[model samples]
Target: MRAASKKRGIEVTSISRPIKPSDFHDFDLILAMDRQNYEDILNSFERWRRKEPLPDSAPNKVKLMCSYCKHHTESEVPDPYYGGPQGFEKVSSMMY
Candidate 1:
């Protein structure tokens, strides 16, 4: 992930495991890479909603990665785990 971001001249900061809302309190928004990833994060957040001692009106902070697109991207980058170079090329093209 560092390599990919750097290759595009994109800077990134990392987050530790997000087990608590306070862990992400300083972050404005969370971005999930895809549907499955979004679902996983949503599930974790749902549990937090029930168990964490959060404020009644804390700001909402989660979103889809593709929603941040506008510079060039218009949709989620499909996972390339089963595909080859052509698939990767597609994702790269979209981001650029």
Candidate 2:
């Protein structure tokens, strides 16, 4: 996929991985790709906070990626897993 995209002047790569607690402490901003991801990241932070209480400012660290957009058409980024190529293209355009 990366090679195919690169051929077209679009560079896309996958760095998919499970979100970790240290990610919260490590990065100032943690943007979730979608709602489920946002919820999961919040839940992960809750668990991490319980184990090793973070600063009261911790909750402010996470946010939905779409929130950064100038025109907020969607509250969350839609998952394209079950859809066709157009779905993926839409998300790519939204993210871009």
Q: What pairs collide in candidate 1?
A: none
Q: Which stretches of candidate 2 lie over 4 Å from their true place?
A: 1-8
> Candidate 2: what lDDT?
0.75
Worst 10 residues of 2 by lDDT: 1-10
* Residue 79 lDDT (model 2): 76
* Candidate 2 local Cα displacement, residue 9, angstroms: 3.6
Model 1, runs deviating above 4 Å? 1-23, 55-59, 71-74
Q: Model 1, 1-96: lDDT tens per residue?
A: 444555677655875464456745656677776777777766776677687675444335667778877666455668754456666555654565
Instruction: Quote the positional error of residue 96 for candidate 2 in Å.
Output: 1.0
Write down the TM-score of every candidate: 0.59, 0.79
Cα lDDT, model 1, residue 48: 79
Superposed by TM-score, candidate 2 places the C-alpha of residue 20 at a distance from the truth, in angstroms, of 0.6
* Model 1 whole-model lDDT (C-alpha atoms): 0.63
Looking at model 1, report the run of 10 residues with the lowest lDDT sum. 54-63
